[model samples]
Target: MIMPQQSSKNSGLWQQATLLPIALVAIEILVINGGMILDMTTSGTSDATRVLLMDSPHWFLLTGLVLGASEILAYRFLVKRFAKRPVTELGATGCIKETALGILVGSVLVSLPMLILWARGFWRFNSFAINSGILKGIGIGLIACVFEELLMRGVFLRLLEQKWGAPGALVVTSLVFGAIHLSNPGVTWLGALTIGVEAGFLLGTAYLWKRRLWFPIGLHFGWNAMQAAFWGGNVSGTGKQSGLLDGTLHGPTWLTGGSVGIEGSLLTAVIGLLAAGVIWKLTPREAPEMAPHEAKTPTDEVPDTGETPAITASEPGRQTRRD
Candidate 1:
């Protein structure tokens, strides 16, 4: 069908603004349906019940990976065609560093909260084990981190910030992030709120600080991975799986997080805010004054002197122009 025409600026702006939510919904549908098909065909489930109850990790990984690729392709298309921007700034080296820092920051933020609970005698160690589930869990974490960050931080936050500025975007995205988890099996209002205040702002802030998805993705992956793989905790009310450590909670549901995991606890909020503050402070500040000092063009960088304006060992007393 033919579409209404719009100015170039408005067209680009709208495309940059709204494509993320569309992409999110599209990916979810594709992943869910694709997983169902794989499960039904491979698991010999001839009925709807089996499809709905599908839990095979193989199908999950296959669907997640395929859809993850699709999401990236979609992102590239939007960025190049509609947004009219280069994808080069998503530098490989920078992504790795940001992701690693995110993981480290997330690990510390999440662990500290749980550790506080443990210190208060709200948690206990019950058992310990490791299995193939850990790999599956990691795969799930990877997919979740990449996709969620792409949607929430990379796209949603960017658009929102453009329209509403940082504070508005931060709150909106954070609340949305928490709201999505409300459908989790045992999530309570308080739990969801805690998630909003803690993870929502924390991850969004991580993205805002670095202006890259990798950092938030790493933070997200590390947070879920630690909760699932390391602690064997129920993530967002999902039942716990085999992890490196099998543990138990022993205090009020509010303090220990009951089955919803430590993310539902009060301590998480405090630590999350602290981590966000640290990340905000650590981000490199832009040297705005350097902009005016830069050469107007490549040719303007040098003088007629035999030597370029660049300082060198041979010109000990000579000074280079600041620009």
Candidate 2:
């Protein structure tokens, strides 16, 4: 009988990682059940209420917003309870800038493979048009990203990083990400495996490197938006709307990604892996050090002891009090 080694590091990793999937399921259940109830009450129909509440652009946007808000609140609450510092590390304040960067990175990376396929005669662009639906797509993209990123990167990867380090966290998060998509329409073992290899690592690393949700959230949103809403490609085989550039894949299914879309192609996997490598290199070798006692916001300096603070961060050259 071999006894398992009782290393603290491995123990910590398992503990933290274990909590992530459970937490994710809880959040999804709350959101889905809550959304269903809201829909049935408002629409006076419980038949297929889940679909009725979540099957449109407006619903996507609304659900994303609601989920995003809940995620933020939950994150802050968890951090306050479990971690030693404030929730500023999540980049809640610099959201707009981080999201913009994520969108840019995600769009460029996701498009590169498509462009290559098109140039190589493996894919073709046919009907091209921009319409009102694009707006809905963008909205859906923004909100949907918030929910996914909040779970995968912001919660799961972030917590895992504290215990397993970046490499381990990246691997775990990516595998889980891909596994969850197995239930999506038209997904094969190859498709699921490639998705794990291509997107799981990329998105997880984005969060690991940045230590912020915005970058990965943006990337997640931008990738789907470009693939499904822009190129009219199938997204995880769920089908997409007639997008800005309706196209057809002309070559082998291996190259063209078949019905599962570009993400299923080996080309996408290679490109995504390369992009992940670049992101890893660009990310700090180690996390930036937080001050022993630091302020999360300017208002954090205000004294609550019935005394006016002498110097706020607003005051020039004022030294913060040390703990």
Candidate 3:
């Protein structure tokens, strides 16, 4: 794309502007997390503390992570501020509520068909009532929730929503989030769709409600820790995790999700729906819009990135200078 004078001027400024917070975050993660990794390895704790655990430190670690990731502060300083496009309480709140409700409804919608199939003797639901260790279970669930939510919900979703508007940003991010998880171990089409949309609902709710990374980060971390570590059920059907349960599931793939994990199971869809519904209840009837920033650019030359590129008279790519 071509550039305007102002955008050209701003590049040097914005480049550093953007990188500032990112650099700080990178440094912090590497330093703090790196130390944690080191401590675990050196003190013979690596097998346990290397990954997240359902324990006190894990909770603090997740919380510290968000504090370290407050790039929005950097955003305010670097970008020129702007305003909303005439937002309403319904648009924002409804979008959030509907996002959660839609997930809940959609999850149930998908699972119900499968449940009927199981009942009709075509298949069976395989989930077993098992008990993993308490601390161990919590740890596993927390890690899953925290890491996935932090990366997808906290990082990607926020950035997309910032530029693409809430609807476009949230949907695309959710899809991407689900697609990425497909790489795990036993990701099936059903599981991917179920968890992806379900994840979207949970994270989307946090985004709209808190407008901060901490809540989603903490919630994601906590849930996963509980699910995988506490119950010892294979998370998403990948494999036997070293969780509290330390056992294998039996029955039809649908019931137990055989190795593709629960995300692909009918029960997962049902659970996701119920969870989304609960989120909908918690969300407010009214919500606030994202704050605005300046718009700079020549109409014809704005970069394809959702952001509107702006420039100044003195910049190298200035229309006047280029022409």
Candidate 4:
């Protein structure tokens, strides 16, 4: 049986592990809804006009900004109170460069499979046009990727690592992340599993390799935004999206990913897994340093007389005796 003190300690640790993610989710929902309600009340337009305005690129961009700010503030406050470590993951140093690299990587990952489909005659493009929908996709992708990376990589995975180490934490977080997407509009069991394995490993390794959030955030945003911008298809089963290219996908559900978009395709999963392996190999193997409070103290050495010896600075070879 566990002792009372041990049980209490375990309970405290569990709370510490869980509280931040839950609070962050709560803050996100509250802010998003609050923004919507405030918009609805202040617009004073007809119902149809209000709906159109809410769907506009400007509205989404504004919401993304507000929501991103609120989540960041909450994350900072919670980490300072509980983890007691500097928020290095969200540090601004090299963020732009790293994020740009991530975007390029993400675009490549999604592009390869889509290109394969197109070459096989499963996907066809009709025309191209510049439109506001691309901007809207950008806004949606920004909000989603930032919110997810902050919660998943910044808090949940990091906390789990404290107890389970990196490997175990990666596994748990991947499974949980995939499970969360199971509720999406067209996601199937296989799709969810693939997401858990593919995205989980890809994003998780990205974080492990760099020890920063910007890379993974940019990667995620690039994937979703590119899907909407180029293909005019569903992204992660979020439903149809407007894109700059007028196109249609026609093929077996397994090959084309059907309503779930390219993420559900077997080819995408294979490519993503390979990419994840490459990232994992590049990741450093060293464990992160312990927080100051969590570091172990060195035991003092005592002689047979049960007195600790201290070296004297004044004498090169002398030991000081304690009274």
How do the residues 6-91 of candidate 4 rate in per-residue lDDT, one tens digit apiece?
55545545665688778877877886676578665776667777778777887776777777778877877776676666778877
Residue pairs with clashing backbones, model 1: none
TM-score for each predicted model, relative to the true structure: 0.78, 0.75, 0.51, 0.87
lDDT of 4 at 280: 86
Clash totals, every prediction: 0, 0, 43, 0
Query: Model 1, range 1-323, lDDT digits (tens) per residue?
Result: 33332254456667766875587668778776765566657766566756444555555556566766777777777777766666542546687788788788777777887777778777787877776666556656666777787888777787677668777888999999998888989888888988888889888878777576777878998898778778777887887766787778777877877667888887787788777777768756532111122214465455666765555454678765643
Order candidates by TM-score, high to low. 4, 1, 2, 3
Candidate 1 stretches greater than 4 Å from native: 1-6, 39-54, 284-323
Q: Which one is best on TM-score?
A: 4
Per-candidate local distance difference test: 0.73, 0.73, 0.51, 0.80
Pairing residues by index, what is the TM-score of model 4? 0.87
Candidate 1 positional error at 255, Å: 1.5
Mind sharing the TM-score for model 3? 0.51
Model 1, residue 116: C-alpha shift (Å): 2.5
What value of lDDT does candidate 3 attain over all alpha carbons? Answer: 0.51
Error of 2 at 89 (Å): 3.3
Q: Per-residue alpha-carbon lDDT of model 2 for 227-318, expressed as tens digits?
A: 76687777776666666888788778787777678888989999889888988898888853432232145654565687655644645786
Native-to-model Cα distance after best TM-score fit, residue 240 in candidate 2, in Å: 3.0
